[model samples]
Target chain A: MAEPAYLVASDSETTGEEKSSSPFPDIAIGIDIGTSQCSVAVWSGSQVELVRNTRNQKLMRSYVTFKDEIPAGGVSNQLAHEYEMLSGAAIFNMKRLIGRVDTDPVVHASKSLPFLVQTLNIGVRPFIAALVKNMWRSTTPEEVLAIFLVELRAMAEVQLKRPVRNVVLTIPVSFSRFQITRIERACAMAGLQVLRLMPEPTAVALLYAQQQQQSVHENMGSGSEKIALIFNMGAGFCDVAVTATAGGVSQIKALAGTALGGEDILLNMMRHLLPDMDTHFSTRGIDEIRRMGLLRVATQDAIHKLSSQSSVQIDVDLGNGRKISKALGREEFEDVNWEIFEKCESLIKQCLHDAKVEVEDISDVILVGGCSNIPKLRNIITGVCKREIYNGINPLEAAVRGAALEGAVASGVNDPFGSLDLLTIQATPLSIGVRADGNSFVPIIHQNTTMPVRRDVIFTTVHDNQAEALIIVYEGDEKAMEKNHLLGYFKITGIPPALKGVPEINVCMDIDASNVLRVFAGVVMPGVQNPAGPVMEVRMPTVDDGHGWCAEALNRTYGSTLDLVTVQKKGAH
Target chain B: MYSNGVGHLPRSDPLRFSFLHSTRLENPPQFVSFRIRPGPAIRSSLNDTISERPAMSFYELLGIPETGSLVEIKQAYKQLARKYHPDVSPPGRAEEYTQAFIRVQEAYETLSDPRRRALYDRDMAKGVHLAFTARRRGIFDEQMEEKSEWKSRWQSQLSELKRKSMQKDSDDNMSWGARMRRERNQSS
Candidate 1:
């Protein structure tokens, strides 16, 4: 019970190398979690606050319910109405079903989710459930997010009276790296200590780099450069970063996430108001989960009154004789979520074309979460960031207030009028790779690179005494290897036989500065010492959840005899 | 297991959590094995950068000249990023002025950008990246089939352009009176 923030961040790196005893511990905190609301925050000695639960409600509703067998969560249950939160015993989107996989088409469109998801599309882990009182109750999205991070660590250790272990959460830049290893195994099963997961628009560009370092202490010029661009759009991710900041750091420079959001605009307006909503709510009975919890609480109250009215008249009936009368205006709910707002303008034009940032050198175009309150996603992100957007924060507490200002700047918290001397700089939102040429996806850490990095590539063996290889480790940036996102695989097995493209392997990859992810590999062969095998690391993505049919059952139980490739170099990238 | 994709469930307490102290109980849904001490199995790109002669030439790390402008490389990178602003420097010289203020802001972000200072002025006039392999293969068609704009063709491309202009003056550690007036106009 005493993992005291890794014994106070390794005893402040062995006896205070003081910048106020480093490794961040102003009781760190800041959570977010959302795919349907969850909060928490901290640094309260003089700012970032949030933490409200005794139903004073500072967001909550992310879910746990199980109607008694001791389940509860969404921070101390408290769920009273909205059809007992679309009943069938509660369990909400555990952030779009955590580290996904029932052959994930977002877990087969969360099979008309009124809970009890099921999906046996073969690649595994998607049975979910909650339907309690009429029997069904299973669980695991890492035990409903470690039971909502143990009620957000006992409501931030009863409001900072201390001992609430590190944290800083806020993910989704299209997660993957085995959904950040099941959100760090649901924050080490709530004995919490994640210290920094970040990337929800780099925690809103670390709260726009502490609001441009408190507007650079009331306008001091010389340090120019702001750039921003954020655009979050919540309820299960839709990122897009582009940072740049300066002085109080914030780098990022280009992300472009997309597990599209507001749960695909409430499952595309509940399949445009039940056009036989998946054969009348696919069935777990109990009257089709109470007529799919009354048309998902009348389509979440006609999409929250079509965000300040323009026409909404859902009129559901489903008491087992389906009946939906529609009217949903706002240009027919923007023609039923216009391909999720034309995929939020190609994820803000591919994050300003991978941060060669343009839209007139953006300065601010922020827009945080909860589908950044619609108006056709604020006139298509203010007409593709031709600026005028910055809804001045609070789009559902701007990603846990930029993850509680990156939990007071990576917990080395300071700010003697210098605004928490910060430093964000992260990026690599997917593109880790490794699945040789013929199999394809070879990337080796490419996407938006930066982040506590360290790379390595050189691959080889492809047959002839391939002796043994199978390294697997994927994570999307597409281009085959079965369209990316695997994240773990090993099996080196003494390869001294050499030949085919003759050994040399290498691999490496690092990532640390706490976005964890190790990998390693190693193999050699020329004048071989301990090469041809003995070095297999693998910490990534702690692989799980039908790693796409375990990379098709390890390529049908080792097919191309442990393949490997990309050692290409005629001027490599 | 959802029909074999190892989507990791077969749980009933497969030792649920204990990730980072480098758990070596090997394999399960639980992992946190740090390891990584095995350093030298030999590598080279020479111990990856920070102490290599490879850096230094963003116009001599911003002392700026070869036609510097973007307003003199943003006023010489805002006076060397305000004399290396690691929180206004001087607190135990803020990590050696934040690693020379992040290589003087990565040489003022590659010389205040006009297409990354025209590709860092053609990789500082060919210290060998032949215009970065024709700007990363947007094809220079092997720089017009290997150098010669017909300047009296090749004496082996004039000793490979006099050893790439003396390896771009020892990688811009500078000794250039315009490379001694192009080696006395290629020795008259």
Candidate 2:
């Protein structure tokens, strides 16, 4: 029940050391929940500890089962190899069912899973079952997630011998806003305070940078010279993120990813081989043959073996008193998984394009993922980009190590890796604009501009005898207000009624260090000597803060009953 | 429900689940009550009659406009309501304030809607009785008159007006104020 392995591994060492110095409350835990497996790691002081399941394995099957009774014999006996058969209740790959409705693409694709998927309508939303086969109870995705997180929280508490409160959960970048909300809600239900949500690829990159900094300190020229690209290809997905160090600051430049990776490649091989066998064998016979998890594992092993070997043979037990064996070569595996390779290639290309860097510009291509160990994948990457791929670190554990490093940085147990001082610039520029007569005014703040920039614009009142003005702010480069999302707006009330152009309102917008915009407005008087007064600072509401600026602006502008008027101002001699 | 656009039956629908009947409670007696209601002292007013009643200073009551700007209208409503809201105001004045606020809200809603505003204006011009029922019926009738030539003509005129304003905005690039500001800044 402790936080997952990948979450705390980087910061574990620091925490272990700190434990001896002072008694610090255990607040942070990390979790890595994968489709086939799940792992938890907890940080105590400077030491990082992992909780192993009964099998002495860090990864859980991601399966849950419900029945009238719990399975007897608290632990499974590996000697009998009867673990799968003696189950009173078992569920597998429940993570896949989390936050997914029946209509979700992933849910539909998962129908082929050997497990049963139950459907239930809860309130206004529908939830899908996560486990294969048994359905004793119906639960929402958030509830399933909460079950996992709660277990993790308990594990951490047991290790620390005290209560743990704060947690950081890693999510895929492709996860939508709705999915993130479900995850957050699950964390809340589990009684763990979610301090922050880190993207999986970002965590992996941080880990890699931290390790690279320690080993190749001399090779890294200066605080600003360290630059590397982290390529994480996991079972469910693959992501590529570019990070650079300049002035001791390390920041993510751009990230590109895809849902298809090593898992799909293995699954596709099964799909092809299984259907072909079905043509020759009975459908039920083939079903029995495919039920064995070992067959899938054998196929994956063969693929992994073929990555290094010129050829490999896979022995298959046909379930009955028959056995068949076939030899597969590297070329054969590549041909079978060409589509998946293409997807990885496209994602890498997108990452490069987003970062505005070419393959030649990349100093190092660090590969992290269990699949990256496949010889064929490494060869393909090397051949395509014509660069030697770095595999010095274990692909499977690299993300965990990196996550721990980030933990150390966040908890202030260790100084951020030397790459932290990178003068990295934004990959995409943010623009601020206003809507006028259905069109937008996009002025200054060009995309990719350095951070901490301020811009100002002046405008006259839209109508005559207008005492108050409403200014709507938006983020994005779209020319229409409808297209761009409105961040928020503020009202400048108590303006004296002047001819349409007589009064001037100066609106100044400043994007601070954290990339959040702050707006201020003031009324500028005409030629008369007037005492200077402080400008009214307006507080912008965040999307997560419950109040939306757009709704407020709509209520202020559209809710108003004033009519438009155009009046000429008296000329001054 | 589907025909009415609510779409599909609820999951708890009795017809969908046969087991629901077993869980249902046994028959219960139904209760009925009857009462006689008194008629109002005043008869229902006609839309034309209300429209014919001289246009009161509803905008002034709301502190907005017969021709107020959008900002002015919003500010006036907020200010007037804050002062006269039943919950916020004195109990003795609550009823009067509530009535005034309701009247202002009704007037604003009518004028804010172009179709309602037009019908009211037409009734006022014709000196016709403006009863709520008649106004509602007239609006519904107007909505149902598809492909009416008069509506199309008015739409075309509105579109032309929009196009002209957009063009004028583009043409007048350097306003006097902007030019003066530039000159003044340079001199300073």
What fnat does each of the candidate structures reach? Answer: 0.00, 0.00
* B78-131 per-residue lDDT for model 1 (tens digits): 566555644333212233344565556555655666775676577667774332
Local accuracy of candidate 2 as per-residue lDDT tens digits, A481-557: 33344556666777776776666665655543223345666665565333124455654433332222333336344
Tens-digit lDDT string for candidate 2 (B1-188): 00111221122333323332221111100000001010110011110122332345444455554566544544454455434433222212223333444444445445545676667556656765343434444433432342133235434654564455456656767444333323333453
Q: Candidate 1: give the clashing pairs.
A: A24-A411, A24-A412, A124-B2, A476-A485, A545-B7, A545-B8, A546-B5, A546-B7
TM-score of chain B of 2: 0.35
**Shift of residue A51 alpha carbon in model 2, Å:** 5.3
Q: Candidate 2: which docking quality band?
A: incorrect
Question: Runs in model 2 with CA error above 4 Å?
Answer: A1-22, A42-56, A67-97, A118-127, A130-136, A215-224, A246-248, A276-298, A308-326, A414-573, B1-188
Model 1 lDDT per residue over A284-367, tens place: 577777777787778877887888889977887786455888787888878878888898888889889978877887888888
Q: What is the DockQ of each candidate?
A: 0.01, 0.01
Please give the lDDT score at residue A452 for candidate 2: 37
Most TM-score-accurate candidate: 2
